[model samples]
Every structure is written in C-alpha cells, then in structure tokens.
Target: MPHIIYNINASPTSDAGVYPIILSGANGANYRFEYEAANLIINKAPLSGIINNCNRIYGEYNPSFSMSFTGLKNNELSPIWTKQPRFITYADKYSSVGVYPVSVSDYDAKNYTIDTIEDGTRTITPRKLVLKVNDSDRLYYQDNPTFTYTSTGFVNGDDISVLNKTPEFSTDATIYSNVGMYAVEIFGAEARNYDISYIPGNLIVNKRVLKVVADNKTRRYMTDNPVLTYTIAGFINNETENILLKRPIAQTNATILSDCGEYIIKILGAEAENYDFEYITGLLTITKIDQVIQWKQTFENIHIGDQIELLATADSGLPIEYIISGNVEEYKSGDRTYIDCLGCGEVSIRATQEGSVNYNPAMRVVKYFTISEDASIDNINSDDYSLNIYTKDGYVVNGSLSQQYIEVYDVSGNCKYHGTDKKIHVGKGIVIVRVNGRSYKLVCK
Candidate 1:
C-alpha cells in the first residue's frame, strides 16, 4: 500500500460544547488517531408569544387596530399575524364587519421547532345612513310646488338643507308646466352626525282638460271635396283663445277617393302649450258615380241547336242587363236571358248595367261560343268505293276496299285514327272520318 488516508464529518448540533473526533487508517496494517475540537457555540432557538389583547376596529372610520403580545423576549422575534375565519395575511385596515384571528410568530426562522401565539378575535362594525324624499302631491300646469322627505340617522339640526344639494326640481313654475312624469332628486348633502343616502321621488304634472268633437260626412264620387272639421273646447291660453284649429295633416298612406269605401281622417300633431289636446279621428263615406260590373263564362264544345241561358253576376249583388248579338237570338224572361244557337258559327253575349245612384256606368263583358253538328256524312262517288270499318271488338269491311288514305276525329276535334289500311280499329265513340276529300261520321256502337 502506498499511503493511508481518512476523512470525517460531524452531525449538526443545537447545543454548543466541546466534542471529540476519531480517525482510522489502513495500509496493510490497521492504525488509529484521536483529536479534540473546542470552542463550538450554538445560539438559543427563537421564542414566540401569544397576542391576548386586540383593539376593536371601526371598519369605516379607522385604518388599523393595534395588538399586544406576551411571552416574547427582547424583540428577538417579530410578530407576523394571520386573519382567521379565512386565515390569510393580516391587513392593517378592515372594511367589513366580521371576527378575525391574528397569530404572532418569530421574525427569525430557526432549524429547531418554534411556537406561535394566536390572539383573540378582533371585531369590526359597519355604519350606514339613508335619505328619502316625499313627493305624493300632484302638480298641475303652471303651478309651483314644494317637496319634503324622511330620513334615518340624519338629524334636521345638522346644518343640512335639501336646497343646497342638486335637486331635480326647483321652485320655478316651468318645472311643472309640462304634462308628464318627473323625478325630483336631492343628492350630495353632507351631514355631521351620520352619512346621507339619497333616494329619488316622482312628480306628475297634469294638463288642462280638453275634448275634440268631429262630424260625420259623405262624399259623392268624383264630385265633392269633403272638408274635415272639428270643434275644440277648454282652451286655456291666449295663443288658442280665439284661434281656430286647422285640419289635421293627413298621413301619407291614407287614401280618400271615389272608390266607394269608408275613409279615416286622422288629426296629426295637434297640441297647445297650456291646453291638454285630444287626438281627433273622423270617418268619411264615399259613393260611386256610376254602377260597375264584371262577368265570367267559359264556352266549350257547343253543338248546334243548343239552347243556352246567360246570367251575369255583379260584385254589388245587383241585377245585370244582358244584350245578345251575333249568330244567336236572345229570349228574355224575367231577369234571365236565353240564346238559341242558330247555326255552326260564333255568337257573342254581353252583360251591361245602366248607371245608378250608388254605382258608376256598368262595365260590359262579352262571351263567345262556336257551334257544330255532332256528325254528318257527305256522299262521295269513287270507282274504288270500297269502305271498311273496325270497331274495338274487331274489323269489318264493306265491299272490296282500295289503298286510300283515311283520317278520323272525335267530336271534340281530337284525331282518333289515321291509316291507309282497309280495316282500321277504333274505340267506341262518335268519330268523324274523311277519305280522299269525302267526309262521314261513324257512331261506333
């Protein structure tokens, strides 16, 4: 072995005194050594005390409350307090009403265990004040009014005058001159004994009583221009004493014309400073200068010798006069008119009404119809006069048929058959046939 080495360390100690250290080394053989260390000193552990006395804090008035502690020596440790219920760091000033605990601890932290002192609870209280105003009296236009109120914790002798504060209404008569609701408030009044809180009050101003009377009138169509008139009473000021109220401005959407209907005449923006005005609404009735009417009818698939009656209807639910002209003759009985289809042509019937007191001249509407025979055959002479017909059941041929073109139509003018064969099949109906410019009608039974 080259050389022997030894290392040593001592455990941490709280007490100060002399102590011994032993060392051992080995180099092929065991050896031991001893030494004494001196002058080791350990300071005393920090001590903490309990706080027993605490001052009551007025959260509103005071900034902080002082505390007293016991069992602490020489100011060796500083007091660090905690607020209880919540157990947070203590604050100097208190703002809310509650009981809080404060704990004291040493400023110097030691490795050894230490004790802390918890103090008794500190109490905080709140102070509040409120003010209110009384405004139960009703006010009228052009009248001056006074106001009063009740209070809590605020005395009348505290040099407090409501007029010195910001008031919603003063003694001026103009404050109550309008017909509306008003709030009278007195705020920011300072008092010596207690805090002042403000609550607003209401004042209602009434206007002079008034009424509007309107007259009912009628207008004739395109003939008369009706003027809207009204009467006003209870005028309170010289501005309207001898003044005549003009007709109200008409609304943009209002229609007054000869269309024979009820119309509304509204008085817009009618007001007087000292007088309470009422909205005026009026009605005007209009009558037509002449009777007006309309008629509707559909003419389809009319046959010759068809006797048709024409009846005209009007929106006014009045009788309509009928006039017939064309290929048809009209027969009148009572209020009804009949038309006899004379031939295969077009005929027109018109509806009309003479002028009446409640209506303008009647507007006329005409209806037309075309008449035709059901089916008729015209004889044709052909060398190949061979004719063949086919019913829905089967085919039938008369004589020897030739290769001639054939076309057939229904009574409603719809083509039913077309071909070049002698025998053609068809459904059961009244059909018109044309072969090589000759025409015939077949009633398929």
Candidate 2:
C-alpha cells in the first residue's frame, strides 16, 4: 500500500465540495479516498436609521439643513461614510413668495441601496399693506382742491403715515391757473409691520376764457340778404340774461348800385366779455340781368283761307302784340288774335313785346302765304296762250300771254318770280304761272 497526504486552503468565497486523495501501486491497482467540507453562510447588515424626518424654514432667506444617519458600520454591506446627503431643490434660495418641497436622500455605495429619505418645506411671503386713493378730481381755477386716502394691514391703534407731502395740487403754481390736464401723485408709506404701495392720480383744472370763431360767406347782390353768425366758446346760454355779443356793425353796406365785381363788407364794433374778438371778411357781388327771348312758332306753307296766329315769348312776362301786312287781314276773336289769308299772296306778320324793368324789347317776323289754283294747273296748250318752263340748267320760261300781271311759284307754293314780262328766270324746279286769270303748270327741269 502507498501512503498519501493532502492540505486544503479555504476562504469565504471558497466552494463547498468533496476532495479526493489517491495512492497508486507500482504494478497497476490504485486506491481513492474522499473528504467533504461544510458550506459557509454570511448575514446581511442592518439598514441605516434616519435622524431628521421633516423640517420647515423661511424661504425669503437661504436655508441650511443637515441630515444625520446612524446604524451604519464599517463593513462591505454598510453605507458610505464619506458621502454626504444630497438635497433636491428647484432653486438655491427661495426669494419669491411661495411654498417649496425639498427632498434629502443618502446613498450607500457599498450596498448599492438608499439609506434614508427626508422631506421638508419652505415658505416665503410678502409684508401685508393695502393702499387706496381717488383716481381723479376736477376743480375750477382759483378754487381749493383736496384729496384723501385709506389703507389696510396695519396693527391696531397704529397710525399710518403717508409719504406724500402735497395732496392738493401740483408743485407748479401755473398748473392750477392753466386750462390743461395734470398728474398728482400719492406716495407710498413705510411702516413697521407692512409697506404701503404707491399710487398715481389725475388732476384737471379749468379756466374761464372766451374764444370767437366765424365763417366767411358769399352773397348775391339784390338777391340774398347778408346774415352774420358766429360761434362763441366758454360761454353759457341763459334765457334770463343775454350772454351773446352785440351784432357787428358793417363799415360798408351792401348795395345794388355796386358794379358787377367782388366787393368787401367790413365788419366792426363787436364786443363780448372774457372773449377775444375775431371777424372774417365777407364778399358781395353784383351781376347783370339775363335777357331771354323766344319765338314759339312761325306759320309757313299757308294756303288761301288758312288762318294762324304768330306766337312769340319774352322773359319780361308780357303779352305779345302782332301787326299784319300784305295780303292778310287781322281779326280778333275773344281774347285771341289771328291773321286771315284772303288771296294767293305772301303776308308779313310781326310779333313784338314792350320793354320791362328787367328785360329788353323783343320782336320776331313771320311770313306766311296763300296758295292759288295756278300751283296745280297743267301747262296751257292754246294758240292764244303758250307757256313752257324748264329748270335743268337754270329756271327759264318761254311763254306768250296777253296778261298785264304774271306770277310763277315753285311746287311748295312759294312765289319764285312775279312780273309782266313774257319770259321769266327762276330757280330749277316745277313751277306754276298765273296770268290773266289763267293757270298753267310748268315743269322747269
């Protein structure tokens, strides 16, 4: 048999298992022996203890806090002794007026766990003071003005002293005398318990002064009457007393005899109290009267037995008078007048109106006619009387007649030529000839 010896070293992390001790024979056969070791058990360390759980402090100033922890031993499972507690906060200092929650935590580096967590709160508040004052005030010039104010958040029986030196008016004396807007201030007050706030207000002072304003106008001569109007400021209207200024005097009167041109009417001697005088120059003009004349109608192409009254008009508003001459007779029926055509001849009519104060005399001439049977009569073809008329180049007629008077008329019944000669010259058109009570139609073309 062979003898064997074995030595084993074990640590805390050593594994628990069986070991073998072997002895070998020189020929072939071998023997083995085994030994077992017990398993090692380690206990966990205790958790750290929290000394301070919660706290509170003022936020207006910087706050200081300390977190103390116990039950931590110098071992592998214990908390880190060199590490300090960390604080989770939104800002470094709480200057604003509000409440804040702070968290305090301790970390263990060896055990990888949180030891303790603490919570705390901080609050900041403003000093209480309430101020009240009037927003605005109005007063007349040379009148006394005053103001008052009130406050809150003060201790009982404690008087509140305002820092405002002058509460009535502005520092400048001219501000009250002038008519304008101004600002008045109500200063803040500093007290032991609370601070009073500052406020601003407005002051309005009015002055009594008059201002006159007028508008310039234009007028027509002998047609429009001139009227003066004005606007006065800073004055009141009353029925019991007259507050208006006197009517202004005219230096030059408006007259119809002025020439047709632009003229000035100077205004003077206007007075009022507490007001300044102002006047605007006015204009007057004279113009000539317009003359209008019209002829309503003229009677033309009139035949025999045709009656008509000549019509005419004038702006002077007067009745028209007529005078008839030539181969017509004037006759009146009722209030109307007319001219009567008796024979185949032209008649001259004249319409006239007398001059008036505003219009000149007007006249018009009307020439009318009467038709004869010779206008439609065909050319006479007799041995005793032969008439032939042509109007191609010019009016020409070759005729033989034993008559003392001869007359030729166009197709429109207008007499073209009248004489006692056998040959006649007239314009180019169809014509009729009357000779010795005979009628003949002559085509002068």
Q: What is the TM-score of each candidate against the true structure?
A: 0.30, 0.25
Model 2, 220-251: lDDT tens digits are: 43455456454544543321116435645654
What does the lDDT read for residue 212 in candidate 1? 69
| lDDT tens digits, residue span 231-288, model 1 | 6666554445344344334332224434667677665655544455676676777777
lDDT of 2 at 442: 54
lDDT, model 2, position 390: 33
**How far does residue 105 in candidate 2 sit from its true spot (Å)?**
27
Screening candidate 2 with a backbone cut-off below 3 angstroms (N, C-alpha, C), the clashing residue pairs are 378-441, 390-444, 391-444, 391-445
**Model 1 ranges with Cα > 4 A deviation:** 1-133, 136-139, 142-148, 154-170, 174-214, 237-247, 250-257, 274-277, 290-328, 331-445
Q: What is the lDDT of residue 44 in candidate 2?
A: 32
CA shift at 56, candidate 1, in angstroms? 19
